[model samples]
Target: MSEYSQNLRASYEAVWGTYQQFTERNEALLRDILVEGEDYYAIEARTKDLDSFEAKVDLPEKEQKYKDIAEVTDLSGLRIICYLDEDATRVCEQLGELYDIDQEHSVNKNEQLDPDQFGYRSRHFVVAFPADRAALKENARFVGLRAEIQVRTILQHAWAAIDWKLRYKNSAEVPQHLRRRVFRVSALLELADDEFSSLSVSVAHLRDEYERKVDAGDLSIAIDRESIDIFIEKDVDLEALVALAEDIGYSIAPNHPNARDPYGGVISTASLAGMSTIDEVRTKIAEVVAKKEPRLRQVFEAWREPDRPPRLVVSKAGLARLAIVLSVEVPQAVALVEKLPFGPKLQSALLDVLRNG
Candidate 1:
């Protein structure tokens, strides 16, 4: 290797090392904001030699201009891919706050672009180390070096990887006919992105509606598949009565202590089945309270200062009946019933279930 090549390689290594450090620091910050259920992944820093320094000696005019140039980044690039578009934006925003961004550009595939240009689209940001961060490192050599950060959704990354592989294999020289074919492929990828975005929106809407119906005491509503299995395993099938209440817009809060208590599991089917209006739901719940008052007194007398409140327990048969009513009358009622309180709300939920049935 030439003396200049060795120097450039060393410079690239230093720059690449700095880039890794910066990304590791920022990635830790990103982990804090990631949602509990979502998947987030990071890519390793990629380094490539620009080979620009070699031109300085051969070309006299370029030699004068680049004489002072220490190093140009070898393809030392880093890409951060996020699962969701929102996540991409959030990561980008956090990066902006943490780094000194030079030039930020975004390309939405939905938008129009020149047909002739190579269009593997993504959001690119040219970033430099922050001035404050510069003090942390003694070496001033990498102070002005800029690294390119590309942000893309998973789908965009899929297209980019394929496009990149093709370019590498063919040396980026495409016949005119193949060029048009590539453009068409790009258009198809754009359409796929739009379709995915639309499907995501629709799924969100369905979830919201499910929650609404459950809260309104619509006992006929179907329960979420996973939730149903959980409830059945726990023998808390009566919880479906809460969904019935939710379908009718009755807000039922869970009693955490009672949720685990086998005896306190008594949920009132009468209150839920009887509630036609919001007022009636409340009145029916009051009746359950009136009944539970004497039972609590008896239980307190028997065991003074019990660790937990006595749950208005119902039988397994009653829960099965409630489930049947909810499933038959309001398919979404089971979702609401699952969220109801063990005592009053449970009773009301049961009544709603029976009435709906």
Candidate 2:
């Protein structure tokens, strides 16, 4: 609100649209970089409002004051809040490859902390897309403008959001007595953030190990949801299933959970037909899937409804169980329609699908 900054408001407002466009383009570029492999909790872009920018320019000490409002680095801001603190650094590394990082203006907030301190750990960067990136269709305009990018862990983001909502302009505004308590809360958040990152790394390591075992044809690993995913991704004869599904006028979504969890839902259903090993389950499902045409002829022989085509297209789990049922006792499946064991609605639906054959 100083007269000095008051004179600069119009100058800030003049290029506002260009900066908005710049931030949006910057966000898109960041998204493409992340899509290459990195995933984050959130990514967003915003124009630093006239009010916040004004405060920054006016509030700094006279010796540090900006001679021009355009000197402010965060006139446009983009934030990439990630699940792990390490990912924030990874994001920064990737960003450096795509843009010209204004090293003097940016700071590694995490690196600034003292040995025992736990506080705001955000990475801020001032950057402009390099000429090659600037030449892209979407980024062609607003190529020269720079924006500030902030990367933080979710916990750090949580602390930042709460701190901002409290409207404390700076550390000095918090009561001297409550400052220690605030620091303690930050320490706890820091601990949780580190633990989350460690957990993520550990799980990824375990998955990689399990995938190796699956690749070697190891069936010793217990059939479970996660294990099944690895098996389907690496082990299963998916082409056979796809061909069978198509032959029966059924479309198979290869990515369906049951298809992935062959060792899980599918295997459990196969167990009723005496399938225990992964190989056995795979063979039976393939056989049952292949028998669909013949089985349909048996079930639909008495019922005639050409107009209402039977919804034989079921999820992999249902298909697995239906195969077991048809392979074992076709009469037992018909018997369940009247008894309605799985519940009236589900049993009725089962009858409708099977009767279509």
Candidate 3:
């Protein structure tokens, strides 16, 4: 081994624990910036093992760019894999606020890849702990250490995983014909990635438009989860419900909690009950309030417990559902309960809420 190799190994070993600390502390801090749920495919960090570090430093002069072992920026690397191409940009923005970025050395690989290029794309950011985090006693040890952050959409990640398996360092390594095929494959994946983003945006826009229509009292609009949300938010049937509750002298009110949906959940229930349009939904709610009245209020009151205040903010859409179930004309509530998207046990439990309350 060369004297340089000896010194490099010595330096690494002397602070190997600190590098490991960088992975641990950064993994924790990085996760804090993540949004809840499946916003990204994964969040992970790894410290480069000694053997891999040795191989990198020992590469032939032309291939090995490391002038010193310390120059390798990714000794401790944190990778954030996202589900969509657009998510990568969101992640980078959040990360920028949380850490110091060594932008000069980092690469945004997605921008470099043209439609015809071989698939290797991710945003690499060299990050260090922010001042506030390092100032904390528990995180102080990892203060100056840098870790690479790689962000990519799942499709881009798939290409990278396959490329690593193929061990092809460059597109030129493949025959001309195969290289052309590879280019085609990358283009198709890029197109698919864009389509995913387009669909996500379109669906969100459509939902927003639906909410707007419902807000405008467009009864012609069909009832849906999103639309029903606005209906509940505005306490659309509050006047009638409060009147009924007042007649019974039951306190429901300013704080009455709403059911998420049967209003939405009972799509099948609503359909079976011959209810479809939001106009029909409103009509059925009126009927339930007439017949069930205080009992309808009782069901929402049942949502409360011993000390909590009455949640008058009940789903009027729910009353529409209950009206359908409680209606003597149609198939009874119990029969349709079987079709809800839940297990028999949950169905039985829900039935109990309606029957007993």
Angstrom error at residue 210, model 2: 2.2
Tell me the tens digit of each residue's lDDT in model 3 across 61-134.
Answer: 62445555567788999889898877888888888898888989889987876544567888999988788877
What are the lDDT figures for the candidates, one per model? 0.49, 0.67, 0.68
Which prediction has more favorable lDDT, 2 or 3?
3
Question: What are the runs in model 3 whose C-alpha is more than 4 Å off?
Answer: 1-3, 61-68, 114-116, 223-225, 228-235, 238-264, 272-274, 293-324, 327-332, 341-346, 349-357
- Each prediction's Cα RMSD? 11.6, 5.3, 5.3
lDDT tens readout by residue for model 1, 126-185? 666688866665535556666666777777787778877877223147776677677677
Q: How does residue 339 of candidate 3 score in lDDT?
A: 65
lDDT of 2 at 136: 80
How close is every model to the real structure, measured as TM-score? 0.50, 0.74, 0.76
Whose TM-score is greatest here? 3
Ranking by TM-score: 3, 2, 1
Each candidate's number of clashing pairs is 60, 1, 6
Best-to-worst ranking by lDDT: 3, 2, 1
